[model samples]
Target: MNAIEVENLRKEFKSYSSRSGLVGAFRDLFTRNYKIIRAVNDISFTVKQGEMVGYIGENGAGKSTTIKMLTGILTPTSGKVIVNGMNPHKEREAFVRTIGVVFGQRSQLWWDIAVQESFRLLKKVYRVSDKDYNEHMNHVIETLDIGPLLDKPVRKLSLGQRMRCELAAALIHNPPLLFLDEPTIGLDVLVKLKIRQFLKEINEKYNTTILLTTHDISDIEALCERVIMLDEGKIIYDGSLQKLKETWGEGKQIQFTFVSEMSLDTLKELTDGLQVTWKQGEQANVWTAHAPSALLPEVISRVVNRYSIQDLNINEISTEEIIRNIYEEGVVHG
Candidate 1:
């Protein structure tokens, strides 16, 4: 079953044109001249149950607007959004009951309350039975390692601590769908890793569907199997992460450090066919071209014969570089 479905979804807001002066501001308020700013253009996609999907885009690209519509916090101007086979905006209460939302910059927990107290309040708000609530809370605390932080007031806890509590609070209701927006933003490396692991485990064990939005590519790389990329409020690409890599990620870099200070011009003369993408000093050089995989051994042999060998490294271009290239140089589909 599809956990979330959007079809030709469109949202627009009235944006007024005004000058910088007080007269212009007064005229704008009185005249009400405005233009339609389409925050979310006609875009469509479906996310199946138990799938971990990454929704990524740059700032002001309507990512938050889309999430708000899905969570029933905002209504779209046109088109349809169905969550768990129900219209989210129309069935706000029922829709909210089945999903949990976490925004990294915001807090759902009470500032003055202890972490455990907030959990108890959530238990009542969701009307969770004592037994089920205890079981779920125990499991979440154990998984997120928040047992040590349960008695501390939320305001007193550090960012990482508060983040773990936020995750625990969101999951306390045992919702089947989770919408996480930049959940690891500004977190330390160790805390980020722990959070990622916790999310992976929850998705695997509970079969929960997750739609994670973040600017951090590492988060998407570690968590999502499928990625939906948005640019200018439109769907640019949607596919398996590996396929995106294979399509845009071409060429590899080979770096070599010579044992002796051999002149770059001499090396270039010897390997003139190889595209020397970058050259630095007398000891290091990088090459990229349509060379066969077998050509590496032959090139190394020639280089060793001409100059003393020291160290060499060859690696494929990074995924970040590939995605950036795609965004900069738009993909042309045949």
Candidate 2:
């Protein structure tokens, strides 16, 4: 069975149309004039068991709204969201037992309590067995290096430390599915690397299904094989990371090192009318442009023959460039 099945899911929020004043607030209580904002439009997608999927979009793209609905924090305005074959909203108490959720900017751990105290409370709440809880706690604490931090109050820990603790709290029960929203936000490079490694180990060792939502593209690139992109509350793209690139990205950035430095105008003149973009460096002249793979040879030849080329190489397009190209040009919608 699919880990998640969202069929034509949607969520709408109501906003009042009133002036900014106490009188407006009092009038709104009597009249109740409000406008509907479709935070999530008709969106449908399925996530297979153990699949690592990236749910990404720019601000105001309904990414959070969709996740909230699936987690049962907010009921959908229409359609269905079934997680692990059960309606998340209707079966919330039972469904939460099978999943873990983390939001980078928020903390699930109690502020005034020591970190391990929170863990103990979680054990009781989840009704974890002594054997499983101890073993899992050891693995989580050791893997994340939170042993030293277990005694510290959550309010005393740094953002990065708190985040690590939060992750451990989520995994303490060994839930089959993990929902992470911006898990790496505000973390330093080293901290982010640690989180990524931890996630990889869990997926490989236990086959934990992860649904990650993040504005950080690197998180998506590192953790997700499949991505579902949303635009204005609509599903724009859904497929493997490579497929998204192949369909929208013009692969390969060819770099040329000439015998001598060439100005942009000179380079453009050499490869005229071919949509070639060029740049010059201290040691070598550089050119970055988009060219289809099929016509790459002819495109290369046109430049190589015209200029006194020293050396050249081609590189794969970056994930950032690919996504940017999509948003700039591809008007994908539900």
Candidate 3:
């Protein structure tokens, strides 16, 4: 079953022009003029059961707007959104009951209340049975490693600690679908790893369908099998991560460190047919080629014959770079 389905989902708002002066403001209050802003413009996609999908775009690219419509927070001006076979906007309560949402900038927990108390409140709101609530709480607490933080007030907890609690709270009802919006934002490396692991576990164990929106490419790489790229309120790219790389990321880098200094002119001449990107401390030079694997041996031989070799490293073009390039270069599909 498709966990979420959207067809031609478009949302628009009337942005009013505010007047600066008192007289203009008074006039505006009586005669308000506005322009139409299309926050989400006729975008469509479907997420099946047990699938992890990444929705990414720049600021004002309509990622959050799409998510809000899907979760039934904002009603779409046109088009359709069906979550678990129910129109989200019309059946808000039923739709919400089957899904969970976590926003990094927002907190559903009570500020002065302990984390445990917050979880208890969520349990009641979701109408989770005592037996199922305990089981789900134990599972999430163990997976997120937030047992130590349960007694701490949410206001006093660290960002990482609070994030773990938030995840635990979102999952206390054992919902089948989860929406995570920048769940790892402002987290340290260790905490980020922990949250990623927990997300993977939940998806695998429960076959929970997930739609994640994050600026962190690592989150997409580590979690999503499919990625939907949005730009200017449109779905620009929707496909596997590997296909995106193969289409746009065609170059790799070969970096070399020499034992002794070499003249820049001579080094440039030696490494012809490669784009020299950087040099380090008179000892290292980085070059880019269409295919590093095909050119590594020949490049190394020429560099070694001219200068003493120290260390060398070759790396494929990163996914983050590829996505950025696509956005800049504007990759369009029919």
Quick one: best lDDT, which candidate?
2
Q: List the residue pairs that clash in candidate 3.
A: none
Task: Give residue 302's lDDT in candidate 1 (0 to 100).
Answer: 71
Best TM-score among the predictions, by candidate number: 3
TM-score against truth, every candidate? 0.83, 0.84, 0.85
Off by more than 4 A, model 1: 20-26, 254-313, 332-334
User: After best superposition, candidate 2 residue 62: deviation in angstroms?
Assistant: 1.0
Model 3 C-alpha RMSD vs. true structure (Å) is 3.9
Question: How accurate locally is residue 105 in candidate 3, as Cα lDDT from 0 to 100?
Answer: 91
Q: What local lDDT score does residue 283 receive in model 2, on the 0 to 100 scale? A: 53
Per-residue C-alpha lDDT of model 2 across residues 186-300, encoded as one tens digit per residue: 9999999999999999998889999999988898889999999998899898989988777766656777877766677776676676654454445546556566666578778
Cα lDDT tens digits for candidate 1, 1-334 = 9999999999899987776688878887768777999989998999999999999877887899999999999999999999988899899877787999999999999999899999999888888999998887788899889999999999999999999999999998899999999999999999999999999999998999999999889999999989888877788888888988777665665666766555557866877776443455433443332233456676666777886666777778677766776676776322
lDDT of prediction 2: 0.86
Worst window of 10 by summed lDDT in candidate 3: 282-291
Ranking by lDDT: 2, 3, 1
